[model samples]
Target: MLIDSHTNLHGETYAEDLDAVIERAREANVSGMIAICCRLSDFEEVSAIAERYDNIWCTIGAHPHHAKDRPDITPDELVEIARHPKVIGIGETGLDFHYGYSPREEQFRSLRAHVEAARRIDLPLILHTRDADDEMADFLESEMEQGAFRALLHCYTGGSALAKRAAKLGAYFAASGIITFKKAEDVRQVFRNDIPEDRIIIETDCPYLAPVPHRGRRNEPSYLPDVLTGVCETLGWTPDEGEAKTTEAFFRLFSKAERPS
Candidate 1:
């Protein structure tokens, strides 16, 4: 079985036929998925989807882009929300200085808030970082000095230094459809030899980063095989071996998820 580690299955893109989409994912051998929450409004919706789908899980927290709006959010509040049995991770949150949608300072604050919440609740932090590797790495280093927290670099597209730093910090690395792109061969090679299969995960990051052959279209969990295929091709492994390896790795990292409980 395969797992799409980070997906936005509750978004409007699936509003028309979410059931069919999930069914398609199952048909494609996707055993489980994590419906990520990018905004506070999405927490309930993401949790609802996980509850409805037997193999689905959810995470609760804000994205960096929405950090300014959730300025008053507290780590305790996030822990309270994550007490839900279906919630397994603390965030899809971190710095996104590439867009500057929210000021850099607010992004850092939001990142630390989510990190603190994860430490408080004992769940992994699913990070979304883009074009802020230097600062993100710095913050991660400083935060580690205070205390350690479980985390995964979701849809990782950063430079070698950031990837190596994350690995050194014991954080998992989730590769998305971006790894399959022709332009991302360099990115693929950077992680190909360095990242252990046990510390790697495959994600579609649905409604974004659709793999080749469907690159320009809206992505979904059902198309995760393309991402898996890229991972296998780059690593010189068979699809079945890749599936088993990644599925094992995924369940290990997101151990909070059980058989529909």
Candidate 2:
């Protein structure tokens, strides 16, 4: 069975037909989904969705885009939200220099808080990075030296240099729909050569980068197989092998997310 390691099920786009979305994902052979909480404000809804579905899990954190609003958000606050068993990870947080939605300083501060919280709780730290590969590499190396923390770089599109460094730190990497793009050779290359086979995982990052064949359409967990197709192609593995390995990697990284019965 396949698992979508990242999904924004709480996004407004899914409000009208969430039940249908879940059913379709099930029909697509998707056994589990981690409904990512991108904004601190959405944790309530994200948590409730995780609670309502036996196969669905959720994470807690503020995206770097909202760093300015909560520049002082602390690990204590993140740990408090993570008290629920459904909360399996510490963030969808990191630097997003591509958008510059928040000052670089605020973004750095926000990421440190998440890093500390994940270290304290021994849960994986969900990360997002864009257009700041060098900075991200530097920060992760420094923070890892301070203390090791499990980390997953979701929708990774950074340079291979960063991928190489992250892999050395034992960070996991998630491949999103972007891998299916015709012009994403660099991203596909990283998957092919840089990341360790066991460290690779899959995600939809829905309401966003829908895989090819479903391009320009609203993304959902059901489209994960399409993304898996890209993974199989890049990794030179058959469908069965791709599913088993990625599903294995997903469970290994997100160990707190109990398998669906």
For TM-score, the strongest prediction is: 2
Model 2 per-residue lDDT tens digits across residues 107-216: 99999999999999899999999888999999999999999999999998888899999999999999999999999999999888899999989999998999999999
In order, candidate lDDTs are 0.87, 0.93
Residue-level lDDT of model 1, residues 93-147, one tens digit each, is: 9999778899988888888889999998889999988888888888888898899
The predictions' CA RMSDs to the true structure, in order, are 1.4, 0.7
Give the clashing residue pairs of candidate 2, or none.
Answer: none
TM-score of each: 0.97, 0.99
Name the candidate that leads on lDDT.
2
Count of backbone clashes for each model?
0, 0
